[model samples]
Target: MSRFLLSASRLLALLLCAVLLSACVQDLTGPDDPDDPPPPPVRMRTVYDLKVSPRYIDVVGSCDKVFGSPTAGEFQYRVEVNGEGRTNGFESQNYNSRLGVVTGRVAGQQITFAPRTYTWSSMSSPGRIEAVVFGTEWDGAIRDGDMSNRRGARTVPFALGRRPGTVTIGATSECRLVLAYEAEWVQREVPA
Candidate 1:
């Protein structure tokens, strides 16, 4: 009689174990478990379109008309834009150094230059603007208050472009005046 009772108790335990196993299998096929977390949201990246225009001006000396190559001559320049830890440059040909124009003006129609385009990763800060103008340096001797050998190789600097547009700096020479062709970055909307 005791053996029969032990056998019945073992059968009951086996049945309980099977029930728990079956419940677990069903739970996996159903909705997600309470302890599981949902996936994170996806983030999209944004890009911007930027237009870089490096404007330049002809540094015309007062004596250009008297002893220079051309009171109005076509001069070439290599304009470099440096600021905000970024550097970009462009070279222009047949840039008309207009004669008798002592004032700095927009060179869009007057001179032939290449437009620089850039893609801005972000608009955090548009760095400080400085341009290093490289062209024929003027090496002239003053005789009778007039300059000779007006055309030469020279490197000039425009301290900074605080704002967008034309900026001028003093040539720091008695005979020559400084003119700057300024360059800047223009922010534009992304194309559709």
Candidate 2:
């Protein structure tokens, strides 16, 4: 008829330009169907399991949080205490009943002081403190210049908070694991 109406008007303008170019080619990208790669970076350090009983097996203690590790650096976080369970003389610093055992590093974890404090010896040697929380109740751990007690087990010598009426000692049973740190970078809070 006019070459079949000009080939049906060029097939209706190529189907109306492929329906307006698929309506302006919209996809914006959302479902490529193959995504599962993001989760692998753990082991700087983060431990917390403080279980206390304290009725006195020579009283044990604990505090928590080692996560991602970063108290400052050089070596932050390492406070290990063990109140002689098998009694090799627990935390044996030559195990002399640890001579007036004291470990009080206030704010970051490590509280227990008394390296010999007596008004004049009425016979009072009681020391065990752990509870002063305004925002941070840490005892110790964030070392660099060798704070000693390098895991051979035997770390108790801090003092900052606790010494009045002091009564956290046993009649409670046992539980101690005080170790703290929060400086920054190198366990870098792990999120890369």
Off by over 4 Å in 1: 1-32, 43-50, 55-63, 67-70, 73-76, 83-86, 92-109, 118-130, 135-164, 171-192
lDDT for each candidate structure: 0.41, 0.29
Against the hidden true structure, what lDDT does model 2 obtain?
Answer: 0.29
Candidate 2 regions with alpha-carbon error over 4 angstroms: 1-15, 18-20, 23-48, 56-192
TM-score of each predicted structure versus truth: 0.38, 0.17
Question: How badly does each model clash, as a count of residue pairs?
Answer: 8, 39
lDDT of 1 by residue, 1-192 (tens): 989999999999999999998887855478767998878656544332233455445444432343533343223445565555677765543322322112222222233455554333444344444545444322232221332212222222222233344433234333342324433344433433
Query: Considering summed lDDT, which 10 consecutive residues are worst modelled in model 1?
Result: 100-109
